[model samples]
Target: MPTLALMWEAKAAPGRAGDLLAWARAQELDPSPARREHFTAPGERVLVITWWPAAYDAEVPELPDPPQELRARPVHRWRFEQV
Candidate 1:
C-alpha cells in the first residue's frame, strides 16, 4: 500500500490561534491520528498535515472526515503519494 498525505492551509481569526491549536490537539486523539503542524509568522496561518496507508478501493478508509469548525475557515487540501 502507498502512503497518502493530506495537506491544508488556513488562516486563524484574530487572537483565535490558541483555540485552533487546542482543537487540533483534541482531534489528533480521535480514531484517526491526524497530526497538525504549522508556521505562524507574516500572518496567522496554519498548515495541517495528515498521513495514512492508501488502499486499492475507490475510497480511502484511513483518512478522517474534516472537522466542522475547520470547514468554516478558508482551507485547502492536497493529496500526495509518498516518495
Candidate 2:
C-alpha cells in the first residue's frame, strides 16, 4: 500500500485558529498510522499537513474535511504519493 501525504494551506479568521484546530482534533475517522502537523506564520495564516494510508483514498472520507468557517478562507490541498 502506498502512503498518502495531504497538505493544506489556509488562513483562519481572527481568533478562530484555536477553534479550527479543536475541530480537526475532534474528527473521528480512522486512518492507519495517521499523523498531523500544524504551523502558523507571522500572519493569521495556518498550515496543516495530514497523512494517511493511500489505500483508503478512493473511499473519500470526511476526516480530511476542514471546518466550515475555515472552508471559506483560501485553501490549497495536494496529495503526494510515497515511494
Candidate 1, after superposition: displacement of residue 4 in Å?
0.2
The number of the candidate with the highest lDDT is 2
User: Which ten residues in a row are the worst by lDDT in model 1?
Assistant: 55-64
* Tens digits of per-residue lDDT for model 1, 1-83: 67777666555666666565555545543346334354444355666676666632324333233455543365666777777
TM-scores of the models, in the order given? 0.61, 0.61
Q: What is the TM-score (0 to 1) of candidate 1?
A: 0.61
Provide the clashing-pair count of each candidate structure.
0, 0
Give candidate 2 misplaced runs (Cα > 4 Å): 55-57, 60-72
lDDT of 1 at 49: 71
Q: Candidate 2's residue-wise lDDT over 1-83, tens digit each?
A: 77777766666767777776666566664543377777777556666677776653544343455666764475767767777
User: What do the candidate models score in CA lDDT, each in turn?
Assistant: 0.54, 0.64
Clashing pairs in 2: none
**RMSD, one per candidate, in order:** 4.2, 3.2
